[model samples]
Target: MALFLLICLVLTARLWSQDDPWDVASLRAIEDSATYAQQVGRADQIGFSLGQQPFIANVLIWDQEGTLLYPTSDGFTPIRYELTALRIKEIETSRASAERPFWAPFDHRATKLLTCLHEANICLIYRRAELEQELGLESDALAKVTEPDRTALLAVMSLAVVITGAALLWGLRPARPAPAAFELIADQFIARRGDLTVELTARDVAILDVLMKRDGAVVTKDDLYNVGWGRDFMPNSRALDQHMINLRQKLDPDKSRPHLIHTVRGIGYRLEV
Candidate 1:
């Protein structure tokens, strides 16, 4: 019962953490209105082309001189005092927006971004609700989710987050045993695998050294060839392959399961010990 209550509490907390759909709808409406306003501004030269054209009919367009451009239906009613309200909303939005677009993202100062045709210094205002339809928005701004649906959503999302975090932590955790460490002493070379040691020829050690430096990453044919032979590598040279074969034979005691000096078919070789 306690676990069930705890889960319910977590679910409730998560739901609370989400932005209200109404708020999201309002922001989306504003952004869409701004985009459409920009398009309309580009269409007309005098800044007001094709009737009293504003893509979002609910929006109020204003000029730099604090004159209302669209909704000429109202004649010339300059609402400059509304600038204080718009400025306040702008400051709040800029403050609330997070760095990531996915989480709690709002627009850059709505007032600043909504302003189009700066030559005319025209700006726009979008209200939350409009009974009429829009190009890319729902008929209503309110998104109503049932209680059961919200519960299901919260459960699924919580599980997904937990799974993703676990996967990342597991991937980043330290690898076991680590890569085999190699050392050369006179004629012979030695590689240590925890408690055990594998011995090889000096030439084999030289080839292995290149692969070790790469830290389990595949070493190119050219690199292996060059390191194995003194001069520049040639496509025909099989010297590197011969040495690697000898190294692999010596390293793998079972000879069935290859764990060190892997041949990558056509490309190159990789070491795993």
Candidate 2:
């Protein structure tokens, strides 16, 4: 289940990364509106129309020579702001070359708008922030995902988190319960719990016998070492630890808490059962 959600999340993020065509359509709408305004000589009114749009911070038109045409010197300084520059060069070039009806030159402002929109001579600029805010993007300056797409992406991420948590919980589930009764049959070198019985080596029997005799009392490692293997043949420090581990595994294979033997840090061991 977690793997499935992970795959879904990947696909969702991939799909959301694609550009929405509506952004292009919206820009075209603005272009078309500008074209109409220039044709009818309402060029000065273009700013008013643009200002009405929630996404338009400002509009600027620059000629091929980099000279500011619209929003003349009296309106704004020529310093460029962070902008989305849309170069209509080739597009305008092809359209301008097409045949047209005979007419006189346009009004000064209309000519400026015409030159910006229909000649291969100008670049249109808009504030980048306006475009981002209008399109619901925070960082990626281009390509936008709609509100629904954003919500779906968030939901996919949430599901991925939930699936991961469930996996962890399953891994941390409780250990199996220990048996009801347990005893060490020293004579037979065996450890028994209910119906289960485990055979033990002679050394394991000697160590366990010592722990049981001092039940609920901490038995020093030195005493256990001497008892299990006479002082003349004492093994390495790690030998005793390894033997104890093996004994614990044989006695309670389930390895539940509140074990029969407890290590008293640096001191020694204690027998609880």
Candidate 3:
């Protein structure tokens, strides 16, 4: 899951980088051109220039005459000569407007080429060099920008998760004690009377502790099977029963009515608290 999230973040960054060139400013210019064309009820040409040396020009020609000018290998060729003349006039008008030096909405040089004859033909041109320059500036800006190391962050996050998981496992581990006294061991027996001192192995202590937890409650054979041999189907459980019997003999003086360990008729056994 962590790796998946990391990959997703990296992919998102890559996509954002790819789209960084056509940023908000570029889209705004296109929108403004569309709005102007709609209001004037005539075809409009919008041009944008980019970069320090401004080499490229991008032109958009909108014609209401329903004429389609196909672009050739070299450049666009309009079928209607009148539409071409109108585009040239528009570009010239834009250039004559001295009130604004840089093109409004975009830095590229913009001018009205010509006036439309039937208010149907509009021609626009854009220099490709300007777009390249803009892209170059955007690339440079991206390069100069600093970002956190994704690999390093992922490594740190993975380590944190592993550490947290380990801590949780440790906290959930069963409590145990080091070898102490015989009575301390006997105290682990399910049924306790104040007198006996019992010697038991580590396995024996574990079994006694499990039984003690459910004192006076019937403990099934399957429960003993799991606790003693981790539910190993291959391991015989006779030894476990023998250990219980031995523990009973040690704790109960009268073995007939075993005070420590008692057998249930059809079930398993119980520890009398």
lDDT for each residue of candidate 2 in 58-140, tens digit (9 for 90 to 100): 34444556454554545433222222222223223322342321111111111111112222222233333344554565534
Q: After superposition, how far is residue 81 of candidate 1 from its true place, in Å?
A: 68
Could you give candidate 1's per-residue lDDT for residues 80-128 as a string of tens digits? 1123344433422322231211111112212112212222222343321
Looking at model 1, residue 212 earns an lDDT score of: 72
Sorting all predicted structures by TM-score, with the top scorer first, yields 2, 1, 3
**Whole-model lDDT values for every prediction:** 0.41, 0.46, 0.37
The list of candidate 3 runs beyond 4 A from truth reads 1-192, 233-237, 253-258
Tell me each candidate's RMSD, in Å, in order: 25.7, 32.3, 34.3
Where's the lowest-lDDT run of ten residues in candidate 2? 101-110
Q: Looking at candidate 2, what is the lDDT of residue 22?
A: 29
Measured by TM-score, the strongest candidate is 2
Cα lDDT tens digits for candidate 3, 1-273: 323433443444343333333232222233333333443322222111111112222333334444333222233232111224443333434433322111222211121111111122222332222333435544233221122234443232211112232233234334433212222344543333454455566666666667767633556677876776686555455776787778677665654332456564334565534
TM-score, per-candidate, Cα-based: 0.32, 0.34, 0.28
What's the ranking of the predictions by lDDT, best on top?
A: 2, 1, 3
Any runs in candidate 2 off by more than 4 Å, and if so which?
A: 1-179, 256-258
Highest lDDT: give the candidate number.
2
Clash pairs, model 2 backbone: none
Better of 2 and 3 by TM-score: 2
Clashing pairs in 1: none
